[model samples]
Target: MRGLKDKVAIITGGIGDLGYATAKRLFEEGCKVALFDLKQSDAGLAKAIDALYIQVDISNEEAVKLACERVENELGPAQVLVNTAATFIFKGVDATEEDWQKINSVNIVGTSFVTRYTVPQMIKKGGGSIINFSSVSGFVGQRNFATYNATKFAIRGLTKCWAYDLAEHGIRVNTLCPGYIYTSAFVNSCKVLNLDIEEENKRASEMHLLNRQGQPEEVAAAAAFLASDDSSFITGSDLLVDGGYLAK
Candidate 1:
């Protein structure tokens, strides 16, 4: 809540369910928000939140570089970066080279590209917060999630290393690991798989101690705390927004 007003915050995958919720929260806290995604953002949604949107493929370093420059010139140097952009590729031991490339390009390399360009801007501001989105998968293994979970685990690794590397710059880095949330992604996956939505939801709910899935806003709230001065004393840590899913 404190030390967030007037600060510039950049959120990758900003149009996604979780990322959008975070942008809304940061905007409400008086941060000038910028949304970067692979596709064009809805004008109405951008206008509603009064945030800037740029279409970018984070895997392409050149594009990421340009977008970062544009954001700095327009919204000012970013003091906070939320790396929520990711590609989901669920595969097991049968995963091929292509599968590995697709997931790694966006989930790992792409995240690095975005951070590469954004870090200098943060330095200009004397320091900043970098929120890297990992997941419960990062902490544990899952069925048919080898490709995806590998990247999530790598995200946590990157956060820890970045925290150490960037600490002297006054920047803080941390991973935001969340449990299953009832998002459009969940519904769409159910539809695509022809699974009963209610049954699937219930199945996911039972995995958490709370007996329910988490919400985007709840995760957003945690992100805001990390972005705000309230988390000044925290860094190089994994903040779990899970519903005690890993407790068991």
Candidate 2:
């Protein structure tokens, strides 16, 4: 919690769900934040954080460049980076190239690009933290989610590599693997499928050791620690924010 006061952070995909939660948590800890998400999220979150809204599709190079430029011009190089924006299609290996590319672009390539631009800034700032979002699904096999599973698994490896490479520069990298949470988008998805929303969610909670799905704020707490000195000695770690889903 100490030393986070007035620190700057860039949270890619920050205008929604987990990102928004983490951003709010960090902000509460007295850090300055810059949020990036689909340009569509600008109006909604800009008011919430009272921070600049960056219309960045992390998968697009030009968009990322422009967003980071704006951050530097307006605030400063971020001392923390959280890559939370992700998308995927659920299907078998019969999944098309487009499906693979879409997930890969946002989940893998986009995460890499954000870290690529921001790591140097952290180094310049004399060290910082990066928290990436992975999933318990990545650690285990899942049905009907080929593309997403692959990217999540890929992120686990990327977290370790970045930690190794960035450690010497004082930049710590780690991943937060969340199992399931109640988010509006997910609720809408389940509803669209006409799934018994309440029962399905209850089943999901039962699957976890804690007998409940996690809240975004809970995951955000872990992220907040990693970003602050509370985790000074930690890096190259995958902190499972899952409510015991992987244990089962």
Candidate 1 structure quality by residue, lDDT tens digits, 60-148: 99999999999999999999999999999999999999999999999999999999999999999899999999999999989999999
State the C-alpha lDDT per candidate. 0.97, 0.86
Assess the local accuracy of residue 107 in candidate 2 as a C-alpha lDDT between 0 and 100. 94
Clashes of each: 0, 0
- Cα distance off (Å), candidate 1, residue 63: 0.1
Q: What does the lDDT come to for candidate 1?
A: 0.97
Which parts of model 2 have CA positions greater than 4 angstroms off? 42-44
* Tens-digit lDDT track of model 2 for 7-38: 89898878778989999898889888999888
lDDT of 2 at 180: 88
Q: Which TM-score value belongs to model 2?
A: 0.97
> What is candidate 1's CA lDDT for residue 36?
94
Model 1, TM vs. native: 0.99
TM-score of each: 0.99, 0.97
